[model samples]
Every structure is written in structure tokens, then in C-alpha cells.
Target: MAEQQTWPHHELGRKLNNWGRWGDDDQIGTLNFVTPATRVEAAGLVRTGKSFDLGMPFDKDGPFKAGGFRTNPQHIMTLLPSDTAHTKDGLISADDMIITGLQAATQWDGLAHAGYGGRFYNNVPAAAVNNFLGATRNSFHHAVERLISRGVLLDIARLKGVDRLEDSYEITEADLLAAEERQGVRVRSGDIVLLRTGSYQWFLEGDREHFLGNAPGPCLDTCEWLYEREVAALAIDNHSGEVWPSPIEGVTIPFHQVVIRDMGLTLGEMFNLEELAADCEADGVWEFLFCAPGLKVTGSAGSPITPIALK
Candidate 1:
């Protein structure tokens, strides 16, 4: 892994910081935009009564490698039917257990997932996230009931007439605006935008390495656009939510530092958007009710989510 560069982050952080925008004790950050009225309006989008699952399967074949910083889910059968066959009532059952990283599959990154300048969201000290307690501040549980809202799918790949964007393609603000215009939809405040680069097709085709490396996604320049639009959160169909290989020469994932650390924005990754994209294209409807609540795992940095889009 390369060292993270810290040349322009301080200036950018000051420009887009949301430290006290919500409150001094804020934990959920921009998710505060998903108000009750927005959720009620989003529920009105379900005219066809169709739904799409946007989560990838959790198993050993996921994107992460074994013995790495993160590994795929490991399912173990805790109890077998044969073990209970000696019961006099002839009762038998099977039980299983799953051990995996919270972000091994489709997931939402909590505010504590990234930090810089020795602070988390809302100016929380980075030392709050100790090895013993996971994350004492800005944990995933803070956003559990706040993720329900209208979702807009900006299919950049389809906008460019390609099945998938080229590897390391930097999706710009212009591309996002063009997609919204071409799709005949407009992104509004409090909308959770789902950006589709269509790079997850590589993982679906059994190319985990390709799925995790050099993927196409938003560039650092789009962070200001997101802040200005007041987007509650962003989910993308890729491993990282930004273009790989540090588009800024020496900075690794500068978008994450700006968005997650400074802007206090939540991010979702590894979502399977193919089925949802097909449905939207067929019906010519790009907006839907997106209800994906993270698990109430206190102090956890992130949580796996099986996101659902109802149309």
C-alpha cells in the first residue's frame, strides 16, 4: 500500500467542513436531511409495487482476500440434524453461525470509518475510537433510523452508452448532471444518490480482483457538488466510492477524507445495481423509495446492509 499524501487536504477540509452544521454533538452527519416528510414523499413513489435488492451475497467468494485486512464471510454450521437425532420426540434442527467483517459485503460506512487531522465527524477526537471499544463516537448505530428517503440512480455507464465505465475512469460533476438530465429526472435535496459505474459486473462474472482494483467512480471534484446539492448519502456500485490509483498524483482516496472526514457524509459501497438499473431503464423512472437501515451495532464503524429499492 502507498502512503497517504496530505498536501491539499487542510485547505479543502476548511472549505467544505460540516463540523457544526448539524450540532455540537452530531453523530449521524448529513443523514439529518432525510426528514419525516421526505420519507413520506418517498413512499409515494411505489406505484408499480416492484422491488429490487441492491446487496451482494455474503460468502467466501466476496471481494476481500483471506488473511487480508478484511476477509469474506465465513459460514459455519454450529449444529447438525444428526446431532439431535437421539431426541425421544424426534425433533431435529440445524443452526449456523457467520463470522466476517462488518464491511465484507454491501455496507454503509459510518462517520468513524475515516478521519484526518486527528478528528472525526463534528470535531470528535480520533482517540475516541480505541482498540478496546471499536468506535465510541460517530458509530454506525447513530444512523440506523435515518437512512430512509428518496433515492436517485445516476447511471453514468448507461449515460455513456457502455456496459461499464473504463477502469480508473474519473466520473466528474458534468457526467452526473448529464445523467440526471438524460434520464429526465432531477436530483433534489435529501435524496440518497445511487451512482452506477457498472463495475460490479466484474465481481458477478467471478473476477473479484478486477472488481476491487482500479475501478471507476466519483472523483474528488464531485464532493463540492454533493455538498451543494445537500445529498443525504451516496451509494456506488464499486469497491471504493472513488476512482482508484489516487487521481491527485500522491494522495490515496482523497475523496474519502474530504467527504467522510470533512463534509461528514455517509458512503455505501459494493452495491449490486444491475437489477435496479434494468428496472429503472424499463420503466423510465429513476427515483424510488430506498430503505436501507444499518444494523444497531453500537460502537461499530460500519454495518452490512441488504438495501432495497421499491418502485
Candidate 2:
């Protein structure tokens, strides 16, 4: 008979030997703007009288879609008198909105989600795992209380000009610099860089077959460059930091593994970049972006986000 493995539960020990390789000689510890947001910003880089939901529209056919083993659920009920309180000038509107579904949109990811032996980013010890329930993807990158500084937008899709980024298309370092030079932008250290590949545009148009098929992503050379520049974090309008079906076979997203796992930095996936790109074009510079994600505790990867840019 085979011996059954017992659940360790809370009895975690030293499982972070692999995490030591992620840090560098000068990688900054604390951040400012990239941290989690708890309240609405009274003053920010951009303002709007109406809230343009960054979240993907939640319908069977909405562009922002997530494939998982489970979905969200919710319920709503209305409270009103039988005759509208018998008044023609009721204070409240006649119709109210009630919505319930999977919590498909949230921002959270802890060390427990990745890393070997359950070690987290920065090599946080296994014993420190708390407030995280379920899986590691729910709590992988938590940069709350950190500050994000100036941002740069690298619009690769516009540089390509096919309306959207196709799957398996590799984004090279040349692509990055060409876009930057074309936009007259310079990438600085400790900056939040958003790479717009236009993948989200197709996803929003109900083109699932193509949307999910494959998309553009960076290669190892570009990743090494960004890491060398000491970027705070890098995000994109695609599923991951690397292209699917990989341009070079026998080498899976070596850049992703090297950056996120070996470099100790973070990554943001599934971002909505249309508006941000447009804002960059109008500004004549593809920089000056500002974004802060919601702090959804006890959750894994956040839902879709619609980051904005300012002039």
C-alpha cells in the first residue's frame, strides 16, 4: 500500500531557497502609486463626470471574458409601496438596477500563487502566508502602500496598425524602441510602463476564436532591457507578458519566467488600452499614464482594468 500524504495546513517551513535569485543589487523595495487603492481619488491625473467602467461588460457576449471552473453569483430585491406611495412626484427613480455574477473583476495575487514550495514574490517566507485563501493566483502581487511614479505608454499595436494584436506575434525590443522613438518618449527607471498591443479591442468585438487563439508578447531581450532599467512594473493588453505559441519553439515564455520569477518584478495582464493609446496620440507623447488598481483583499488576480492617460 502507498502512504497517503498529509496536509501541512499551517506547518510551513523554509521553502524560499529559490526566491533568492529574483532580487538585484539596486531593486527598490517600496512603491508609491502602484499600490492598491481603497477610496476614490478626489484629484487625479484625469477626471470624468461619468464613470467609464474599466471592467469588461458582464454579459454572455461581453469582450472581457474569463474561463474558469466556477463563476460568480448575486441577487437583488426591490422595496416599494404598491401604488408608488400614491404620489406622482416620487423621490426615487422608477427603475433600479440589480446585478449579480461571479466576482470576475478584482486585483490580488500573493506569493503563495507562484514560486516553488509556495514561496511568494520577493521570497516571502511560507510561514507569513495569511489573509490568503483558496489559490495563489488570488494573491500573487500585492503592492499596496507602494508608490507608482511617472508612466510610459509603448503602443506596439498602433505601430503595427492592424486594429489589434494577433496571437503568437512576438514583440521585440526593436518594436518597443521604435514605438518610443516614434512617439518621442523616453523610458526611465522606476517608471510604470504600459505596453498597448490592442488585443483587448478584438476581445471586445465578440471575436472569441481569434481573441483566445494567440496574442503578441515580449521576448527575452526586451525583458532583460526593462529589468536592466529597473521598471517598477509592466502591464499589457494581453493574457500574459509573453506571446503564445511562442515565436521560438523549445523556449517557452523565457522572458516571463526570467522577469517575474527570476527578476522579482510584477506583471499586469488583461488591461484595456484603447483609451490610453488614444490619449497618448492626442497628447503627442505616449507617456504620462496614471493607474491604480482596486485593493480587493482575499482575492487572486484582479479583473479587467481600464487605465487612463493624461496630457
Candidate 3:
């Protein structure tokens, strides 16, 4: 049997639990791995001065549609050119506003975003998060400045020689290792690993249904690999960071509960990684200086991010 199938989902969560690993008052989770020295080393990775934006555009046409609990970004023009025309001295300017779900586009799922057994990361009670306050314990605000670090791209789709992996394909720890070997790069401590399944191509092609449906992503057992490697954060080219319609019995999104809640690892979802993957393929360099800081939303469980990779 595969290693991930050996243990129940909840048991895996317990085994990989990182509660109190940092400290009692720790809210940033594994982001603590990105030390000052780590950021300095990551800065040395920029050679060509090329950059890639790995975030999907936040607009009305994003993958998230209406009628769902979370909808796509709705941009409203608060001040249009016509409205600004009334201004004097040609100082007219247009302004706009957006109403969006924090996780509607490319976003970082904070430590409080998922939990099991009425507890969050660091053994914080789920009650700490309330409707009015929203994730008081492991809020996104704590992670705002900690996400910048070295990013390693593990292009699973490219390793498998496919534009995109099949639906519900569960990428395992072995797959990650294989991709690392194939790409000639290694995942190191404090690295913000980006796993590319090429799933975002569907959204770029105007097929939002397929993009949001069952898509390829890391499986439950991969959490162990990430924990062992001390990855600070993880990003994927899918809505959820894990494979959909979860392979585990009686559990949906088991990876989320384990990685986010137990391991205290932040997850970035709906990232656009095609351009970065292509560049990595051409240059044979999979590591880059990654900077994707979350908004200082005081009590938010998640925050939209515009991830950038400098090479």
C-alpha cells in the first residue's frame, strides 16, 4: 500500500502536529523558518533580474462564480473618467473599489483557515475565531512580513510530461521527490515551495468549471515530506492546495486539516505558475527569490497576494 494510505487522516494529523514548535504565542506558524539569514541567501538567487508574477488577475471573470459561498472579485468604479472630468486644473483622477472574498483569487490561507478537533495551530481553540472578529489567534496579519523567502518550483505536470495532470490525481511525496530530481533542484528549509500541476491553464482558457473542479494537487501524505523538509509555505496552481474529492475515506480536504492546522503551514492557492515554470524549464533553474506578503488584515483567515518571483 502507498505510505499515505497506511494511516488514517486524523492519525497523520497527529503525527505531523507542530503545536508549540515555535512558541506559545506563535501565530505565524512555519513562516518562522524564514530567518534573516535565509532571506539574505534568497536575495543572492537573483541573477538575470527577470521577474514573474505568479498571481491570477483579481477581476469579475476569475474562476470563482456567483451562487457559491465565495464569489469572484467584483470591481466597482467609484470614480470614473466622466466623474473626474468635473475636477479643476486637470487634476482629475479615477478611483475604483473592489469587493472580494479574501480567498477569491490567488491568496494565502492563514494558519487559522483550517483546524480540527475544535483547535487551531499551536493548540489555540477554534472559539478564538468569531464571526465578528474572524481568526483572532492565527490571523493573516501575523504572516504579512514572514512569507518572503526562497521559492522552489516542483513542476509535477512537466515531470509527468503533461500539460496538466488528470482530475483527482493525488500527488504524493514520491512525486515531489521525483520532480525535484527531474528539475535538478532541491527543496530546502525556509523555502516557499510552489507545486505546479498546470491546473490553472483551465482558468486561463476560460474553462472555469474545470479549473475549479477536481484537479491535481498534493496528497495527504505529502505533508510529512513538507514537514520533514521544513518548507515555510506552499503554493499550488489550483483552488484548493490539495487534490479534490479527497481520496481518503470519510474526509474531504484532509491535507488542509493536517498541513494548515497540525503543521501550521500556510497554503497559497489559485497561483498562476505557467510563466515561471516555462522560465525554469528554459534556464534549468528552479529556485528564485519569492516575495508574497499577505495584507495586514488584522483578523482575516486569509489574504489575497500578488506573488512575485525574481530570478
Query: Roughly what TM-score does model 1 have, to 2 decimal places?
Result: 0.96
Looking at model 2, report the run of 10 residues with the lowest lDDT sum. 9-18
**For candidate 3, lDDT tens digit of each residue in 1-311?**
66644447779888988888888999988899999999999999999999999998988888877799898899998987787776677667789899988998999999988987899899999899999888879998989888899999999999999999999899999999999999889999999999999999998999999998998999886988999999999999998889998897778788999999888999999999999999999989999999999688889999999999999
Candidate 2 contains a number of clashing pairs equal to 25
lDDT of 3 at 212: 86
Model 2: lDDT equals: 0.53
Candidate 1 vs 3: which has more TM-score: 1
State which candidate has the highest TM-score: 1
Distance from true position, residue 193, model 3, in Å?
Answer: 0.3
Encode model 2's per-residue lDDT on 1-311: one tens digit a residue.
99955322111212211233434321222232233331123124343322223345444454334555324322333655553666777654344343433233222222333343344445554444455553333243344323244567788888887676666778888898898888887776667778888877766776855655577878665765675566766777675556876665554544554455444555665667677577568757555535555344444433233343443
> RMSD, model 3, all Cα superposed?
3.5
- For residue 255, give model 2's deviation from the true position in Å: 3.8
Of candidates 3 and 2, the better by TM-score: 3
Off by over 4 Å in 1: 1-6
Error of 3 at 212 (Å): 0.9
So what's the TM-score on candidate 3? 0.95
* Angstrom error at residue 157, model 1: 0.4
TM-score of each model, in listed order: 0.96, 0.66, 0.95
